[model samples]
Target: MRGSRITRLFRTRPMTHETPYEADTSRRRPTVLKALVFIVLMGLVIAGLLAAATLLRSEEGPKIAIAEPEPLAVSVIPVEYLTELDIDELFTGIAEARRTSRLGFQTGGRIERIDVRVGDRVKAGQTIARLDTRGLGAQLASSQAVVEEARSAHQLALDTADRQRQLQAQGHISQQRVDEVVSQAATAMARVDAAKAQADTIRVQIDLASITAPYDGMIVSRFADEGAIAGPGQAILELVEGGALEARIGVSARVVSELVPGDIYTLEAETGPVDAPLRSVTGVVDPSQRTVAAIFDIPETTGVPAGSIVRLKMERKLEEKGFWVPLKALASANRGMWTVYAVVGEGEDESWRAQPRLVEMVYPAGERAFVRGPLEAGDRIIVDGLQRVTPGARVVPREVQRAEAASGG
Candidate 1:
């Protein structure tokens, strides 16, 4: 019985024992299979995430943004509703004398002396100069001697004729001899009369040697000096008569109709402006230039030199009230046709936009222009930066007052 119990205990102990290699093999096979399954699942998840990222990127739309507009700098003049101001049409012209004369000697002679110089004032019939009178004096002396000699011969013939007449009446001498003496006496008296007339002519010729001024005027020039030979029709000096000056201006045919004689005008000189009256308008028109000559008489004023340049301003008949803008505001698409850009308000927040407006320009006044348009008073217009502006474009209104203050207006 002891031996059988020992065998059963040994078998039961042996039944709990196993090989190490077999245990390891079984555990490693399951672990490797679980690892492969985990790798496959992780790979599928990563691929799905990459595909979703690519699709999201391709389906996205473009990003858009808007920027604020830049502010504009501008200047503006106030518009007011006032009475129509009569603006004169200013014309550029030169000043001249109303009556200018080139004084010269009527008779040729050597200049003995000059009594007047430039800027010298003289009166009418004033002796301005004298010439050499040596030849003239000699001729007058010879004429006077002939007159004396003829007078003596006439007296002797008169006495002889009277005695002969008395003798013939008393029959003391032959009639033919008395008649001969009477005819001689008559011829001698005729010779005396001719000699006296010739002497008188010579006397008058000597008086013209002195050159005198024809009217009251100021001497503007002196062409001949002392001892200079002066010929006939040679200008010796220049004279401005009547103390009146004039300006000769060329007026176009379109404006010539408004100019007439006795119209008043203003002339701008270096000193200041002066009032002048229109003297005359030339009837003959210059065919080549299509202009007429306008003459304005300037009043006598001190220091207003003749031949100086001046500008003439004349009033026109047609007048109206309109906006006067600078010439740069006008744009030309064709000859005589002009347009400008005007700003019209669209809404309170949207501001105004540029709108092309047509105008008819009548004439130019200095740097400003006078135009006729459908726009009324207080219309805002762009005077500068017109090329960048277009119709229906959004713009930021830059206050003109603020810009002017910044620029030290």
Candidate 2:
């Protein structure tokens, strides 16, 4: 009965908020909340410790600093003192004869025979063509007949004059009669002299009927054919003197200005190169090409032909001051200029580096170039290791030996 009464009291107390069951529930809820708070605090402390440990470990490790690369090794070519620069300019030209002539007959006539054809070589005074002299022959014969008749009459008059003079001296004739007879003889002699002059003129015309070459040359063109009537001074053939030849080349004003007569040059022909001397340079420029005409006399025409294409080569020495550098040292720049890397600084100094400088190319001779730029007189330019360097990069400059430099190594 006491147990039952106790159970009933417990059940009835659970219905009230201030009962022992409610107090126990409230205290259990607070204890459970406090335990959760302690677990969260412990977890927070562990996380903080792990983070601190990681930081300490990273600090304790060795610190590695990245090192800079070594300077690039390069060979340098010293800037040379150059007083003059040589420039080569090649010009194309056609070979021509030193002397050319268009041969023709001195008088008009019908062409009868052509002795030579085009491309036939003829010697000096060789007849290249001839005209039919049938008409000239008839005229010459008539002139000769007239001259013979005049001479016969003159001879008779002379005899008569001599006889008359003698008779006058002997008093067989008066002075007036002698004078008249002498005057008649003089008139007859004058007629003979006129006839002789006419005959001589006809002979000269006959000789001129044959067209002849003026010199040893080859016939370049034939303007007249057989049976063609040619007028006086009409061209019948063109001749080119083959012995002495020349090449006429057109060059710019600058190049022509450096050329002078009597200077030796070179002519690159199909056979080989031949020496040619400068003959003439025109003072006036050509209106169409804006270039000056230059004539060079070839030494020999053994392997050269007239009207053949050839190259005229000239090495002009320029007065501009510059320096010669290996072709490998040059770097292309804008406006047709170039760049070069120069090692500038004292020995073993940290400031020693490659500096790029602009340069103007004056001429190129084989593997070297004459250049003018902002470089000093004795600047050391980097020739090797150009591809491995950049502007302002440190470089170890090793001077190239004289022999190697000269050999363009």
Candidate 3:
């Protein structure tokens, strides 16, 4: 029993080394748990860092695209209707005298006296110039002397012929002698007739040596001086008749077709406005100018000097066919051509876009142009703000009133 008790006590008693071993085991377990917790926390932190880096890289790359921009807003007008208009066509013309003449001497001679200078008024039968007639007068006097001598000889011949006939009747002279006297008398008579004719011719020439005005006129130019020698039929002076004035103008064939013989028109002269009546229209066209001559008779009281340039205003209704558009709608292009932006798209879902249409401006009346182009009726054309849009660019068109478009507002 004693041995059993001793062994049980020794076995139940706590050893010093045993207690320290239990404490060491307990400390080791706590350290292992702390290391495991640190490892798990580090793993979690590294995983979170990797996820954040991946997210930042994805954000730095290019993004997905968005929708396109909206279209621009613009005002548009439809193609206008054709109308007949009385358009005034202006032409430049020169004022002229109704009667113009270039006067010259009939015979060649040295000039002696010029009575009238340039711009001198002259009347009918007034002597304007004269040639030296000293030699002509001497010749005329000599011719008259010869005529007088011939007349005396003719009287003697007549007396002799009568005496010869009487002698033949009295039988005192032979028949042959009477015949000889008659022949002599006939020769003398013939000489007298020739002398008289020559004297008359010289007298007529002396009258022609003085240059006289054939009608009332004003001298415009002088070609021969007082001492200059002039040939026969050479121009000596240029004269223009007063009291009636005329205007000569060159116009197109189309204008000539609209004119009449007595149609009245207005002329803007340097002095003032005057009424000019159409006198004549030439049937032939001038080849160089491709125009026809139109003559108009104006009153002399207008005081418009000859060769004064004046403007002729004429208005006529024409059957023209074209569309009128605002000047802002036109875009300058190459070779004097013009472009207009038109809205081409249709329906609500379709987006309206700019489309270029070529046009030619025929006539410009006021702020609008009469244009002809490849455009259909009712086609919408952008008028306001063409610079803000381009061809093929989407545009929102706002319709404009026809009256507003016509008024160019």
TM-score winner between 1 and 2, please give it.
Answer: 1
Candidate 3's TM-score reads: 0.63
Give one digit per residue, the lDDT tens place, for model 2 in 1-409: 9999999999886665487787789779988999999999999999999998888789676777998677777898778777876677788888888898888988888999998988899999887788999888899999999999998998888888899899999999998888888888899899999998998998888889897777898888999799999999999998888786888888888776678799887779876787888889987898998888888887664568777888877677788889999999998899999999998774664446899999999888789888999888888899976788798787776543355568896
lDDT of 1: 0.76
- In candidate 3, what are the lDDT values of residues 1-409, reduced to their tens digit? 9999988998898456557788889879988999999999999999999998897789676677998678787898889768675677788888988788888789989999889999899998999898898898999899889888888888888899899899899999999998888888888888889998998898888888888998888999999899899899889999998777889888888877788889788889888898889999887899998888889898877788887887787787867766889999999988888999988885787678899999988778778788888888898899989888788888876543345467897
Report the number of backbone clashes for model 2: 0
Model 2 regions lying over 4 Å from their true place: 1-87, 315-409
What is the TM-score (0 to 1) of candidate 1? 0.60
Expressed as tens digits, the lDDT of each residue in 1-409 for candidate 1 is 9999999999887753558888789779988999999999999999999998887687474556898466454443333333355667666677776667887766778878889999899899998877777887888888888888888998899899899989989999999988898888888888889888988886665567777788888898888898988887788888877576788887766777777689777778876887788888896787986767888887876356778887776675555656677888778756676787767667765566667878878667777787777776787767877677766655444674466579996
Which scores greater on lDDT, model 2 or model 3? 3
Cα distance off (Å), candidate 2, residue 393: 31
Per-model CA lDDT versus the true structure: 0.76, 0.85, 0.86
Superposed model 1: Cα runs more than 4 Å off? 1-73, 76-85, 88-100, 174-176, 242-322, 331-333, 344-356, 374-379, 385-396, 400-409
TM agreement with the true structure for every prediction = 0.60, 0.55, 0.63
